[model samples]
Target: MAAKDDLGRVGEQRAAAYLSDRGYDVLDRNWRCPAGEVDIVASRAGLLCVVEVKTRTSLRFGHPFEALDDRKVRRLWHLAHAWIDAHPGRAVHSRVRLEAIGIIGPDPRSGMLEHLVDLR
Candidate 1:
């Protein structure tokens, strides 16, 4: 369990860096409310991006993205709104958008990172 958690943390860190490099201002990370947790929340060019990151040590079961099912996506949406509610005025001039990231490798530090923007 610890190893899995460590990998997730590293993956999220990598995702955050990638976003920052692309000019996204990170607002929140691992934010949780009654609905669920949001992996990363950022703002870029008047768009508030809610990012969900999935990390896998291997593809033995499936690709990292395979873990994000419909239910998970729905939960992320709920969490995104909850985040907006929590941080007033942050979304006033920004549109909400969903983003996803998948990291795959034996070690998260050297993982292959793939990012998808504006997921419906």
Candidate 2:
């Protein structure tokens, strides 16, 4: 894998650990459907969260979250719905929402992680 891909993988793993430590039950990771992909799927307080993770070595251009535009958010939503359809038992009667994680550091595992509940 590319260095960039490795960073992202570590960032996603860090994001998952962050959620798990905070009492959220992680249902999936790197979930994909015909529509697209979701970085993380977790639940807490009867709510299902679809998380988009962006990792970068530095913020030379912008924050990691800046990578996601309106188009990407729309695609994430589409992917979330597709995930729900594919996992009926898991997402049954649940309220789904979009979220994001941004990581910036030389080592993503030790990077600064930020969580945004809004993608719009």
Model 2: residues with Cα > 4 Å off, grouped in runs: none
Instruction: List model 2 lDDT by residue over 1-120, tens digit each.
Output: 998888989999999999999887999999877777789999988888999999988999899887789899889889988989899888964588889999998999887899997667
Q: What tens digits encode model 1's per-residue C-alpha lDDT throughout 7-83?
A: 99999999999999999999889998878789999998888899999999888989877777888888888888889
> Residue 99, candidate 2: how far off, in angstroms?
0.6
- In TM-score terms, which candidate is top? 2
For candidate 2, the 10 contiguous residues with the lowest summed lDDT are 88-97
